[model samples]
Target: MTQDPSRADMEAVAEQVFVALADPSRRSILAALASGGPATATDLANRLPITRQAIAKHLTLLTDAGLVTPEHGERRRVRFRLHSAPMQVAQQFLAAMARDWDSRLDALKDHLER
Candidate 1:
């Protein structure tokens, strides 16, 4: 397989994902869309305590991070839905980090035992 990019780029992508997930309200918004399928900001507003305006702001961030996609609807209504691509990339990055740490620990253990 191809080697992963430099740490700087990986960190940037991870940072974006982390920032998108940092807000509790955004997480709720993601969960709502994930569970309820694609929906408008108004639809999400009804299901969540936050106002539609707030949800719209959160959606903008999500879209920027590639976590959510917006579908243009009739009458200027836009539907937002969870996009798994960014999350999948983030998950893979975390798993790779875990594996690297595990290998480093194993090497340390070998050195101490020597």
Candidate 2:
């Protein structure tokens, strides 16, 4: 089936971010990458309790969601690094929603005061 471009917009990115972050292990993997910089799947596996295969699966999902990027270094070493774009998009969305709620609350407060 043909994909819908509109369905894959910023909102979709936000959705992907939420889905990717929903898993605790994935969150830990992301944190590891964020704090330690780029790391190979084996490195992450060693750091976390998760096995290499499990880490690889999470990395694949993260990569697909644009949360992480993979780079090939010398000796064919591939390491994954976090990408901020998707997270930033998700943060912007949450901020906008918070602002909307604040505006509505202020309006309600003013109406009650008047």
Candidate 3:
């Protein structure tokens, strides 16, 4: 069954999502996850310049951020998949920020024109 997220939960989720995306390495990880269905730390490390250990750390952060989840597959291999809900929240937050900036800019323009 699905559970609806509360306001505080959404705020927490959004904070974590933004924090995860703030790092370039994490963003790269997310990109990789988006391109590929799921990948192990070793697989991601092989694709990127970072070491497997570093990749694992990034994966941990992403997992804690609720942007990704690990699934067991093929023995001890742990694969991660993107969780798009928080991403959608991040996108909406960004869009809202953009809109607010636009409004402020429009007001500034009007003030300058007067």
Candidate 4:
């Protein structure tokens, strides 16, 4: 049986996702992958204004963050495919934080209304 990830693990993954997403270039790369599907660094360069070297760098970071997976294609080409698991973990983290804040804020409003 597979064990579920601990909260710490989830937070760590979420942190990596957040750091990876902090860059506009990385975000653009992700958006391109989302719209165009899996693509090589050269393919991304062709689609985005970013250079091939820069896209390769951004792809490295995205791979490290578990945002994308590299697949070997014909002629030894590496195509990057979007991976949403880490992003989902980050979304869960944000949702949990929002829930906590919502409850606290509701309590504060109730206290002030009294």
In order, candidate lDDTs are 0.88, 0.92, 0.87, 0.95
TM-score of each: 0.89, 0.82, 0.75, 0.87
Number of the top candidate by TM-score?
1
The candidate, 3 or 4, that scores higher on lDDT is 4
lDDT of 2: 0.92
Instruction: Record all residue pairs in model 2 with backbone atoms less than 3 Å apart, i.e. clashing.
Output: none
Could you give candidate 1's per-residue lDDT for residues 6-102 as a string of tens digits? 6556656777888999999999999998899999999999999999899989999999998889999999999987898778777777987899999
Encode model 2's per-residue lDDT on 1-114: one tens digit a residue.
Answer: 655564347568899999999999999999999899999999999999999999999999999999999999999989999999999988877886689799999999999999
Candidate of highest lDDT: 4
- Lowest summed lDDT across 10 adjacent residues in model 2 is found at 2-11
Candidate 4 stretches greater than 4 Å from native: 1-5, 110-114
lDDT of each residue in 1-114, candidate 3, tens digit only: 454465446657778998998999999999988998699999999888889999999999999988899999888899999989888877776676689799999999999999
- For each candidate, how many residue pairs have backbone atoms clashing (under 3 Å)? 0, 0, 0, 0
Order of the predicted models by TM-score, top scorer first: 1, 4, 2, 3
* After superposition, candidate 3 runs with Cα above 4 Å error: 1-5, 95-114
Poorest stretch of ten by lDDT in candidate 3: 1-10
Order the candidates by lDDT, highest first.
4, 2, 1, 3
